[model samples]
Structure formats: structure tokens, C-alpha cells
Target: MASWVILVGRISDVDHSATPHKIITNRDYLAHPALFRGQRPNVINLSNNYGYQSRGYYASLLASSRGHRVIPTVETMIDLSERKLYENALPELEQALNRCRKELGGEIPSRLTVFFGIAPSKASDRFARLLFDWFRAPALEVAIRDEKGWASIRKIGFLPLARMSEAEKERFVACLGTYTSREWRDSRTRTQARYSFATLVDPNEELPPSAISSLRHWARVAEKMGVEVEPITKKDLARLANYDALFIRETTAISNHTYRFARRAQQEGMPVIDDPLSMIRCTNKVYLNELMTLNKVPVPPTVMIAGPADLEIAAQTLGFPLVLKIPDSSFSRGVKKASSPAELKALATQWLADSDLLIAQKFLPTEYDWRIGVLGGEPLFSVHYLMAKKHWQIVNHERGGKPVEGGFKSFTLAGTPQHVIDVAVRAARCIGDGLYGVDLKETAEGVYVIEVNDNPNLDHGCEDAGEKDVVWQRLTQWFIDRLERQGR
Candidate 1:
């Protein structure tokens, strides 16, 4: 976990003991870079003035350069200072304002104070959160007004601590306490480690690729490799700049926070598994289907459905018992099997409401699927994912949406078939090489690529069964090598 520090232009800008985190003068922090050379801390810039090239602005600027995560980042400061930059955000802000108009009561207040994403009034809590998500600042004062028949955001500006009333200061303190306490991090200390690693996870995920036990074991392995590991969630987005590298353990989607985390890590120049490019290519089956076919990678005969005409073509071409998939299906959630023409049309019409395109492929029934783990364009491990009981998929969700997974058999690289390993590596290379699980179907004819998964499962005793300690060691080294290459 990153150590926290509060930066202020003047000593009196904030109460000395208002927060448990360390407090330091802006000048002292700016003057002494050696004091924080090796460690990256979370710097809350409560500096008094943020004018261009001012002490406050430079504090945030230097914090970012030194790899410390700072609130009211340099970009945020520049965006708020220029009206044009913030004007584009007005529509969303207006929508949020209107939603809370009733709770705000009568005419929307001309102005409201927000401290650390918390509004003084309980009714504006969600609006405050949205504001914080847009502008990461210690405090903000938003101006609301009547635009025709609705509430609109007129202007927004920073709320200086020096200008806050005593009551507002108390509220700020409480909000700061609440904000800093949201992360559910492990308490173990790794002060001696050379680098910091952030493992992004969702504790409440029903079927997270990596279990908590697996994460703990990886943390232990990381410690032995002189790296510190911490489990972070979406709430820690503001703190991402402090880490040297990121490993996403949760399921990923282009429209979700996991993708946001991956993009942020890349922007920070940190090595991240399941990088944004890999997610874009792996998450969408439409893109993968075209990519594989173009690259000469063997895959099932597939048809892309866009309208009723295309549906008819797919039904006639692939025939009965074909699989239909939405672009972003995962864990067998948005995939369905159609055994007849009517079933195909019914399923396609309903699924098309959400997605513009769908994939229809010849159903190649297999007792098991060959999942080959590939790391950095090299084969890592292999597993046979047996089909669920009386089901054709590895995971069956037919019973009330609860998934029942099948058994898995792990194999060493030498033990796995050379043909399977070669095909999996070829498919993974079609997408950028980070970490991938290339799922393939083996029939009497040949092995065909099914799907290339980004952020594949690394659960303890599952993927690691083949190499165990060797797997963990290699994984840790993969991160370290990238960090070294980037001169982190």
C-alpha cells in the first residue's frame, strides 16, 4: 500500500492533526526530492493557490513526475482552469443536477460546497461523487442555475481551504477520513521490496478469475521476488499512479472499470497484464473472428449477423445446432445454441437489441476444450476444461443463471501436445502478447481456435498446477523484466 501525504502551500491551510496521514509544506516537499526518492506516496494537494506555474500547481506537477499519485492532477488543474476544457462536461453534469433537483428542493441552490466528493447536504451525495469523478480535487464549489425548465451547472471552481468556514472544514475532515478508508488492502508490510505491484480485483465478483487464496499466494511469491503486492479495487483509481506495475485479476470489459484501470496503468507508463489493446481484441468475438480468419488461423466456419437477411444466411449455411454469440460474451453468459431456424431467428432478434452485430458459428461439440496459457507470446501451461454435466459448454448457466463449471486437468508444456501448443501460441499472437488463455476445440479433423481470452484465470492449484512455483516465479519475473525495461 502507498503511504499518504497531504501537501499544502502554507502550514495553516489545514489543521495539523485533521488527518492521520502525514502533512508537509509544499516548499519542503518540492525542495527535498531525496526524502521520497524510492517510495511512491499518495499526495493530496491541498495547496492554497493553483495558478499557472504557482507553488500549488508545481506541487502536483512534481508529484506526478516523481511517480507519486496526486489528487487534482496536473491535467485536472489545466482542465478546470480553461473554460473550453470543462465546457464539454456540462451536459453530464446537467443530467446529474436534474436527477437530484427534487432532493435539492425548490430552486436548485446557487452554490454548493463539496469536500472530498462529499456534499454538505445528503441529497447531493451522488452529484458530488460524479463531480469528483470528473475533477479530483480536495474541495470544490459548484454553481447551479436555472436553464429554461431545468437545473444546469453554470460554473465550477476549486474551494480553497483558506476560504472554507469552520463547519466546512469539519465536514472536509470527516469526508477525507471516509475517502481514505475505502480501500480493502492487506496489512502486511513489504518495506524492503524494490518495486510496488497493484493487483486489481473485485472481491464481490461471483466468478473472479483469480480467487483470494491465489492472490495471497501470488503476493507471497511477489514478496520473495523483492516486489510488494497490494489488492486494489475501482475505488483506488486515483491512487494508480503510485504503482510500478499492474496485474488485473478481475474479469474485464471495454465498458467497465477494469478497462479504465488498464488504460490508466498504461498512461502511467506501468506494465499491465491484459493491456487495453489485448482487451479490445480479446473481449469482442466479432473482431476476433475476422482477425483469425484474415491471419489464416483455423477457426470454426462463422457468419456475422447484422439483419434478418444475414440471419437467414447463417441458419442456411451453418445448419442446425449452431452457436450464437454476442460480441462481448464471457463465461458462457451471452452465448446460446440454436437447433433450428425459428430458434435462431428468435435468439438473434432479442440479442440484437443490445448489440449491433452477432456471431453464428458451426457448433463443434467436444467433451472438453484445450485451454493453453500463453504469457508474452510463449506457452505457459495447458488445461483440459471438461464440459459441464449434460451440457456442451465448459460452464453451464442453464439453471437459474448460476454457473456450474466442469473439471480441469492441468499438463506441463512437455506433456501437452505440440500441435495444441503451436496453435494456441499462433492465436494468442493475433492479439498482442501479454497474458492470454487460448481456448481451442480438438475434433477428429483438427484443432480449431475457439477464443483468445485476456486476463485468463490464474487460480491456485488450477493454472499453476503444471508449473506451480515455476509459474509464480516466471510471472513475477515477467513484471520485473518489464519494470526494468521501462527504467521504473
Candidate 2:
């Protein structure tokens, strides 16, 4: 039979003491060998100065009565003690346990469990430190039961539950228990044989209905491949440390919360699907242009114009029928097409009125573009994006009107030419590994890179001209296989 130890402390204490006197005073159970005449099991209750009123104290007393020994411990004084009291006290507790075994005239019980009574405080405060360090032990399990009397066990690994309110913490803990103990235990035997994995999705972006349909399709694909997909938002990101990877559908900027979440996950050595570096490289069109040009990848002739004086030189280099784009803008909101020098000047002046950084490039006359979905350095699917009827942009251009219906043509295999594949591969290599959509325009000369989007739209029913399931399956399997290899 195993021996058990319980420590009770107050939620609020005026003394501000830090010590294992709670465990130390419970020494009498093991000290008195006669108390355990048979293998009925040994139990020690270490509760004192808990500030529990009559009802709470009496309930604890009744629970302790089931144990063989009940001992009380208290701290008389503590004021500005600088030393790490808990770290120092742990060794003392170990020594005292050894002494108790010696007095018992035999080896101590093989199994020992300790339960703590936690109190709220600053995360760096002494009490928090004590709970964190102690609960980190492999043999220990920490739990908190709220005022509603619902108890839950804490999951292993670092989580932000310390910042949660008592009620929230209790609910989270309870959910953890239910998921791991019940839902997991009831899973298929095959799934149980493989490594466990979890993923999170952020819903910050106001995605088009088509995009939402695409996500659901992919979710189903992932489920079929045995990878669990959990949708989350910014509010849920704070509590999502247990997941192996995160897939964010939101557009990420350097100063945004999405970027912060990615940065933190990277610091923790957890692989993020669309990593922060990938976002930084793909989101900024200017940066993408520089990298693509340096690698000799095909890109539209482009020049940067910081002010009105540079616009003429840019127009001279790129010529008329060009596109002017503002830096750090997406969804084709800050873009305009100019057919002549006069129109170019007017557009640049209006655009530069709001911001300085502008890019001018010759506009390709292609009526449609290709959105190539690349995952883990390999191209998954290619979808042709046709412009809306009478609209130059693929997205709707009419004001206060419904989104324009556009045509799509998907290919399971790389239907793009070999030269285009080679160029896209080189460009994707420069962008590094992550999920991305590269917009390319195929010209008589070669495929020219238009823009790289960090959070590209995925439409399901919009394009099914080819083996769409094959592409979805490949992507799903890749995610599952990667997580399995990482031992998630």
C-alpha cells in the first residue's frame, strides 16, 4: 500500500511565510510505526492556519478522520526573507522523510503522493514559485477544486493557467481530465497506437464564405487521416500551450497578436505551421520582390517610388499600363491601374497622399492568375483565379454589392509547365518552409511572380476540375506524418 501526504494552506496569509512545515508536522504518521500495524495504508493530513471557517474546517477534519494520522503545522513569522524558501525547504523535507523511515525500523512505503492547497498570487511571487517547482516533479500531480466543488487534475507541461481566474482554471482542469481520461480512452485502438497530437486554428480573419467551406473540407480530410483539428481564436490562444502546432488563418503583422503567438511558440521550440519568419517574408511584397530578384526568379519589372519626384523615373522604367501598390496593404485595396503617364501621375499623387512607400510595376494583360498552394516546400494544388465579369480584379469591385462569382480550375498534379515549377520551387525555397499561396502570371516568356500571400484563401467547391481529393489527402497526410515524426 502507498503512503499519502496532504498540505493545506490559506488563500490569504498575513504572515507571508514560505516553508514545508505543512509536510514536516505530518511526520508523526511515519514516525509512529505502530500506527500502521497492517497493510491498511498510511495517510498524513498536514493542515493548519488555513483560515477555513467552521464549515470548511469541519469538512477537512471529517476527511482527515479517515486517515491514520492527523498533524497540524504552522509558520509563526515571515517578513522580507530574501532566500528561495521553498527550494531550501525541499531538501529539509527529504531529510525528515528519511528520518521518519529510520524511526519506522524499515524502508519507507514505495509509493508517496502529495496534494497541495494553492492560493492566488503574482506568478513570480513565492507561493507561485513553490507550486510550480513542486508540481513539476514526475511523481506529483497538481489539481484545484473551485468553490463549486468540481475537481480537476492539471495537465503536464507549461500552460498559462496561472493567469486564469479560479473558476476558469477549474473548468480548464476539468476539461483536461475529461479529454485525456475519457475521450482518449474511448478512441479507436489504431489511433491509440499512434502518437497523440493536437492542433489549433485562429479565426481572426474575416474569411469569405468560400474560404470557410474550404477549411471545413480540409478539416474533414485531416480527420480522415487521423489528425485532430481544433479551431481557436485570439481569445483561446492565450490558453493553448498543449497543442503541438498552430495554424493561423489570420493575416499576421509584426506588431499583431497573431505574430506574438507565433513568436512565443517558436521560443518554446514548438513548430508552427505558418511560422513567424514565413509570415514576415511573405506578407511584405517589397521584401518578396527583393528576395525573388536576387535569386533570379521571374518577377514583374518593378521600382519603388518614395515621393512624387521618383514617380516619373519609376514610370519611365516600368512604362504605361502599370499597377501602383502601397506597401503593407492587402486584398487589392490599395492598388490602382494606370494606362498612361497622366493617369499614373494622378494615381501616384492620390496614393502618396496617404503614404510614401509605393511600388510601380508593369501590369500583365492576363485575364486570370494561378494560386498555387504550397505546403512543406511542395506544391499541393494549383487553382486558376479568373477575374470577375467586367472587373479587373479577381475579387468583387462593385460597392455595397455581393461578392462577384468567378471561375476556378484546379489541378491535382503540377499542371504548370516544368519551367514554371522550377521557378516557383526556387521562389518557395527563398521563402522557406510553411504554408503559402504564390500568385503567378504566365506570360509568353515565362511565369512571373505577382505576389505571395501569407494567409491565402482556400476555396473548396469553387474548384474541382481535377482530383481535388488527392491534393487534400496529400496535405492532410503530410501534417499527420510530420506530427507523428515529432512525437507529438
Among these predicted structures, which one has the highest lDDT? 1
- Show pairs that collide, candidate 1: none
Candidate 2 lDDT at 425 equals: 63
Listed in order, each prediction's TM-score against the native is 0.62, 0.56
What is the C-alpha lDDT profile of model 2 across 1-488, one tens digit per residue? 23433322333311114322223222233123344344333222323322211222222232222233322211100100112212323443344344444334444433222212122222212332343233321112223222232222222222232334566445433433332232111111111123223343444345332255566777787777766666666666555566655666665654455665665455344556567657656665655676677567889999866568877888788887888887555666677788888988888888776553567888887888877777777776677888877877776645555556467777655476666556666678777777677888988877998887766665675543455677667656665666566565
The residue-by-residue lDDT of candidate 1 on 126-221, one tens digit each, is 888888877778899888788676887778899888888888888889998887876522211111123699999999999998998999998898
Clashing pairs in 2: none
Summing lDDT over every window of 10 consecutive residues in candidate 1, give the lowest-scoring window: 184-193
RMSD of 1: 18.4
Residue runs of model 2 more than 4 Å from their true location after superposition = 1-210, 353-355, 398-405, 462-465
